[model samples]
Target: MENFDYNLVKVFCSLFDTENLTETARILNISQPAVSQSLKKLRNIYDDDLFVRTSGNMKPTIFSRKIIDNLKKSIELIELSLNQKGYNDNLFYKKNYNIVMSDLAQSFFIPPLCLLLDEANLNIDINILQVNQLEMEVKMREGKIDFAIGNFPALKDNINLISENLFQDCFVLMIRDGHPLIKSDGDFNNYNLLSLIGVDNNITGHSEVVNKILNKLGCKNKMNIPYYSAAPDIVEKTDYGVIMPSFIAKKYNFHNTFKIFPILIKENLIEVDVIYHKLFKNEKSTLTLRDMLVNNFRNR
Candidate 1:
């Protein structure tokens, strides 16, 4: 085992079939010299002339044929174990996956994502939890959380976590269709009169930026909700309006139930990302879920 790296085994298997160093290198994505070095190591380990150089090709010797079957089986097992996390018929059982999601993700991302997961025919449990930016690192380190989605300010430069930006979202003022502000010809001069509703539980940084803009505009009345999904109902009955992500506003504001208006003030675009710890950097399940999120929400 000391002399046997998986790389050496891979080179051996490729060379066994190709019999040409150039062809083996091409198949393995390595240089010809590297393949020659691996063959030299294999020769030293086996103490046999594994291949005999012929006129146009290298032919495997009788010793090579004797051990090739076992070597092939070993390589197959190694590769299967390496890719064990990939979804398959047996692994997709009643397993629970806990994810930390934001209000925006809950309203705009969860429904479509759940449907996609269900389509995979996996009886898996999904637990979507909420965690603040300051607490995300701790929870991920403890392995109490699987992954998180949203604009996490604390993880922007954190080296311990790996993140992929899915999309950019901007804040929009969502109001009921027949609100007085809509009747006022889009005039926000009286915006201070309406109570401002904001979802701030997920710590996506949108609320902070929007809060500052609301303050600058002298809109004193404010209400903070734990979930963004509740804002649509709250605004439907009352004169309250919420500043939410553009994607959420568009997805939930169906049936002309709400009107979407850009935050007249220049608001910073929030970068939505799927974040996980470095420990799961190469884990196939994490990578699979990340790819799904990118496909579902990435800017088209």
Candidate 2:
């Protein structure tokens, strides 16, 4: 293998993403020979044929796959250091930017955000997605999403991710109408509680923080309800209580149909944040939207 070619890393990443050399060349707007030459240089530097052509796609070798993440980080660091290109307001006019956010954030935060845009008379195309935690970071960096908003453990020291906490939120125990616990807040201990993985709108895994708080709140009877869909069904059929963010409980007016009780857990306040990567971090629309959220929640 020859010494590494700094510029070829971009070519290699493009090939990896496109899979086909022809398509990679087309996307890069380089001649086929130039792409082949770049691939050759990359292969020599890595001491392995990084790509094995099969079915018109380049399958990465094990060694190449192992270094892919680090290579990406380095490239991203370089991109961050060289910020000659930043997000422009004019781009919003021609292209629709994809905004990836959790269902919970969309429920509580998007209303005021959309209103803020309308009020300012900024014409921009936006699409929202509700995605789980698995491989969500990969999707964000791969350009699948221009920005992401929710609980972001996705930030890394070298990766081009930037995050900000919008505000804190808490949970309220809710149950359907005619629930035995509806009569009084103290009656909450009588019904079974179903809760999401975490109280902070996390869809990834169990939260020890939530468990500790619930333990303090006298929730001795609890079930690990993994999905959000379970909340409506369980609350409707029986006297079971579902735990969710206070914002959602209030938004749905759960107090009318169900019993809504504050957990009063002994701990720090739970918070919900809006996060985005550094590539799109400087985008005025993104920052403006973030500020609007902070303001709206403050007023709320």
Candidate 3:
């Protein structure tokens, strides 16, 4: 193992996780040819066919399988040692931080978080991606997402994740101010007469919960839109309404164009949590950002 290239080992581990040379190269920011060459070198060094190209994925050999856990543990240790320098105020200046958030959460959380960053004099580059529950753990493990903020139903009891409760949001009925459903102030007289305009939750993981709320409200008809940002305008134009989080509804109604009414149903509130992998539980940047988010939104 003289002059062993750790980069080749990294490519091997990444390939093991992703099962594709193209994907592994993408994750490591290298060329596909480079990945192939590294795999070739790794095979020569180990004197075994480490991985085999099948009809689908590049399946690892039994030898590779036996060492996968040790390789992961070694990589984790290296990362932990590299990040041992705890939080420093100067570390955040002009650095890029990626966060995974639901569209609804992005709408209401980013603005205030930006304000906090400004106040702290930190010129951090904040990037927000739409949350995908299925790939969240993978993304976090790969450090593709620094932090994830949203109501994650799949991660509620996931042992791999550690979460902090930021706040709880209840369901609200959002309608244009002059809609016929509103006969008077704070009164929705024709709730069932209007159809619902719902944001599709294929990626957001809120469809089941939202559907249950609509069922309780006796809303029989609904139209699904792909994005939540478009829900407000559609509700203002048509007789259709939206059942959304209280925070989003309040933020949307801030200009008085819409009215937000409380849901008259039991357990309508969902706890929005900030989640990260346990591996990063003690990392400086992760802690600093998580603490900032929790403190900013805990009371609001």
The C-alpha TM-scores of every prediction are 0.67, 0.56, 0.67
Which window of 10 residues has the lowest lDDT sum in candidate 3? 85-94
lDDT of each residue in 1-300, candidate 2, tens digit only? 355755677677767766778766754557889999998878766679999988868988888888878877777667555534443334233245677665666776678777876876667777987565555566665556666665454342325466556666776777777665444544555533443233334542225445666667645444555445556666677655666767777766654766577777565245555555553443344555556556666535
lDDT of 3 by residue, 54-170 (tens): 987899999999987887677657655665643345433327787888778887888888888777666668888876688888888676877888888787778878878888778
Top-TM-score structure, candidate number: 3
Candidate 3, residue 203: how far the Cα is off, in Å: 3.5
Candidate 3, TM-score vs. the true structure? 0.67
Clashing pairs in 1: none
**Runs of candidate 2 exceeding 4 Å displacement:** 1-94, 153-160, 182-187, 191-230, 267-269, 283-300
lDDT values, one for every candidate: 0.75, 0.61, 0.77
How do all the candidates rank in terms of TM-score, highest first? Answer: 3, 1, 2
Clash number by candidate, in order: 0, 1, 0
Scored by lDDT, the top model is 3
Tell me the deviation in Å of residue 237 in model 2.
4.4
Candidate 1 CA-lDDT value = 0.75
